[model samples]
Target: MNLEECRKEIDRLDKELTNLLEQRMQVVAKVAAYKKANHMEIFDPRRERQVLDKIAAMAQYKELAPYLQKIYQCIMDESKNYEREYMKL
Candidate 1:
């Protein structure tokens, strides 16, 4: 594909990513409510490890595991922050 075509594809993917992120954040809201109801902490290290391991296992590009981990860490941190805000803590 040409440069313009590649850029258009990226733009389309960006829109898709935005939609997915919104959906993910909605789920994060639900998770926060569940945790609060159960008096559970927002940060679950074991779950985080499991998520990272699962992502790493499913990753198509092995070398991108570290990058994916970094992105997921940021996402998890944001989720925790949202939980805190939602809980008014």
Candidate 2:
């Protein structure tokens, strides 16, 4: 395809990403509730490691692992913030 087509594809992918992010946040809200009820901490190192490992294994390019990890880190940080707010802790 042409440049415009590629750009449009990116736009479409971005829209999908945005939608997924929103859905993930909703799930995070539930997680916050669960954690609050269970007296769990916001930061779980083992879960983070497992998530990163799974994401890295699904990577199409090994070079993208670091970038993907950073992205997930930021996402998880936001989720933690949400959890804190939800639990008022």
Candidate 3:
């Protein structure tokens, strides 16, 4: 494939990733709602550790694994913050 075609493919995949992230955010919102109803904490250290451990083991891209872990950490941190704020409502 040409460079332009590859670029277009990457753009399409990026858009799909954006949509998937939004969907994940929606799921996190639902979790926030449940936590609010149950008076549970927004950030669970055990759960976070489980996620990190699983990601660390499961990531196939050795070169990009650290970057991916950083990305997931940021996303989870933001998600927890979002849940904290959302629960206040």
Candidate 4:
């Protein structure tokens, strides 16, 4: 495909990604509410490790595992931040 076509594809994929991320964040908000009610900490190292490992394992391209892990790490970090802000902690 041409450069313009590639960019358009990327844009299309990005729109889908944005929608999915928004859905995930909505669930994260629910989690934040639950944690706040239970007085639980926002950060769970074990959970984070599990998520990263699962994400890495799910990568279709083995060579992309590291990059996917990094992307997920950032996502988890932002989730924690959102949770903290939501809980006012």
Candidate 5:
């Protein structure tokens, strides 16, 4: 494919990713509500580790593991931040 085609494909994928992220944030909102009601902290190191490990394992290419982990770490960090803000912490 040409550079323009590649960019277009990326843009298409990005749109899908944006939609999925919005869905994930909706669930995160629910999680925040649950945690707030239960008086639980937003950060769960063990769960974060499990998520990172799971995504790493699920990665199709071994070389992609670290990159995927980094991306997910950022996602989890933002989720925590959203949870805090939602809970007024």
Candidate 6:
């Protein structure tokens, strides 16, 4: 494919990613609601570790596996923060 078309594809991919993130946020909001309703903790370190390990296991690049885990950890951290503020518990 041409460079222009490939660039457009990248933009489209980014838009798809943004849409997916919004949907994921909606799910996280629900999780926050449940947590507040049930008096559950917002942060779960074991879950976070599982997430990182899962991502690392799924990574294709050996050198990039840790980076992927780091990025996902950051995303999860922010998501948990959102849950905390949204639930206010």
List, residue by residue over 1-89, the lDDT tens digit for candidate 3.
99999999999999999999999999999999998899888889999888877888888987777787888999999999889888888
Residue range with the least summed lDDT across 10 consecutive positions in model 3? 61-70
- Candidate order by TM-score, highest to lowest? 4, 5, 1, 2, 3, 6
lDDT of each: 0.92, 0.91, 0.90, 0.96, 0.95, 0.90
- The ten-residue window of minimal lDDT in model 4 covers 80-89
With a 3 Å backbone cut-off (N, CA, C), the pairs that clash in candidate 2 are: none
Per-residue C-alpha lDDT of model 6 across residues 12-44, encoded as one tens digit per residue: 999998999889889999999999999999998
What is the per-residue lDDT of model 4 for residues 1-89, given as tens digits with 9 covering 90 to 100? 99999999999999999999999999999999999999899999999999999998999999999999999999999999999899985
Best by lDDT: 4
Prediction 2 global C-alpha lDDT: 0.91
Q: After superposition on all CA atoms, what RMSD does each candidate show versus the true structure?
A: 1.4, 1.6, 1.7, 1.1, 1.1, 2.1
**Per-model TM-score on C-alpha atoms:** 0.91, 0.88, 0.84, 0.97, 0.97, 0.83
Candidate with more favorable, higher TM-score: 2 or 3: 2
Query: 4 or 5, which is superior by lDDT?
Result: 4
Q: Which stretches of candidate 1 lie over 4 Å from their true place?
A: none
Q: Which of 4 and 6 is the better model by lDDT?
A: 4
lDDT of 6: 0.90
The Cα error of candidate 5 at residue 21, in Å, is 0.4
Error of 5 at 43 (Å): 0.5
Which residues of candidate 2, in runs, are more than 4 Å off? none
Candidate 1 accuracy as lDDT: 0.92
